[model samples]
Target: MDIYQICPEFKKGQITLRQTETQDAEELLNCYSDEAAVPLFNSDNCHGDDFYYTTLERMKQAIDFWDFSYKNRYFVRWTIIINDTEEIIGTIEMFHRIAEDEFNHFGILRIDLQSRFEKQEIINDILEIVNENLYQAFEVNSILTKAIPLAGERIQSLLNNGYSPMNKRFMGYDDYYRRNRVDN
Candidate 1:
């Protein structure tokens, strides 16, 4: 399947994943500004302490970049909404990671959620959808996500969904996790 052909929205139980829009900048900025939610984000793209957007205007700029990236096929991202409250709770980003060297033909998944919504079940549910369909969408042989040491709940969810800590020597990055299609 062409990556762009993937649906703009997906529903799984209490959560709904929809294409993010410019209007979501406010809520999304709130999530990013949350003291508890900020640290859990992947530092690769987030750039650790350097990645901060303290205002709606800046967040809108970031959202614009996300939209531009999507248009260029750099990656696909969605705003996560809680069905019951109809609240925007988080965001999910996935991109094809195909390189000529190592880590070829893989999908890199990044999920950022509000601290309150960071539950094992919720994380599992979100990832299950990606695991089920991302291979086809990105034509990847495996999916990988980082679960930092402090992210115990996310680590557990990943384990429950068949992900294992990638070898330190092979990964060269400590504590990174992976779920290969063959493992499923």
Candidate 2:
């Protein structure tokens, strides 16, 4: 499916993933400005964006850029919301990589969340929903995400969800884990 043509929304339990909007700036500011969560964000190959916005204006600009990127088919970003509290906790970015290296045609998944929700269970819940859909949505052989050594909970969750450490570096970045669509 062409995700850019029709962005799909996924809902599972209290977690909801939908196309990000400008209205998300206020709540998402809390996630972008979160110092503790910033380090866990995968900003590799993002042209130094770093994903750290300190103000509402900056966050809005970032959202605008995300919209631009989506329009150009560069990537799709979704806001992660809690159904119960209706809080925007974070965002998930996914793109189809077309490179000359080993990652060519692979789906790159990036999950950024508030520091307080960085537990293994939370990560598992989020991944459970994404893993069930992104492979088909992005039409890729595998999906890759970053989980540095410091992100112990994220690493464990990835492992439990059938992901493994990729021995090779991704676009000169490290600490990436991979999950294939078909089991080997």
Q: Which candidate's lDDT is highest?
A: 2
Instruction: Give the per-residue lDDT digits (tens) of candidate 2, residues 1-184.
Output: 7899999998887689999999999999999999999999999988889999999999999999999999999999999998889899999999999888867999999999999988887678788887888888888989999999999999999999989999788888899999989632
Task: Tell me each candidate's TM-score.
Answer: 0.90, 0.96
| Worst window of 10 by summed lDDT in candidate 1 | 43-52
RMSD of 2: 1.4
Q: Put down candidate 1 lDDT per residue, 1-184, tens digits, no spaces.
A: 5667654577887898888899998888868877787777775744343335688988888789888889888888899988888899879998887678578778888888888888997898898888787777778888888888899899999999889998663335456788888534
Model 1 per-residue lDDT at 62:
78
For residue 35, what is the lDDT in candidate 1? 78
Query: On a 0 to 1 TM-score scale, where does candidate 2 land against the true structure?
Result: 0.96
Give the clashing pairs for model 1. none
- Overall local distance difference test of candidate 2: 0.91
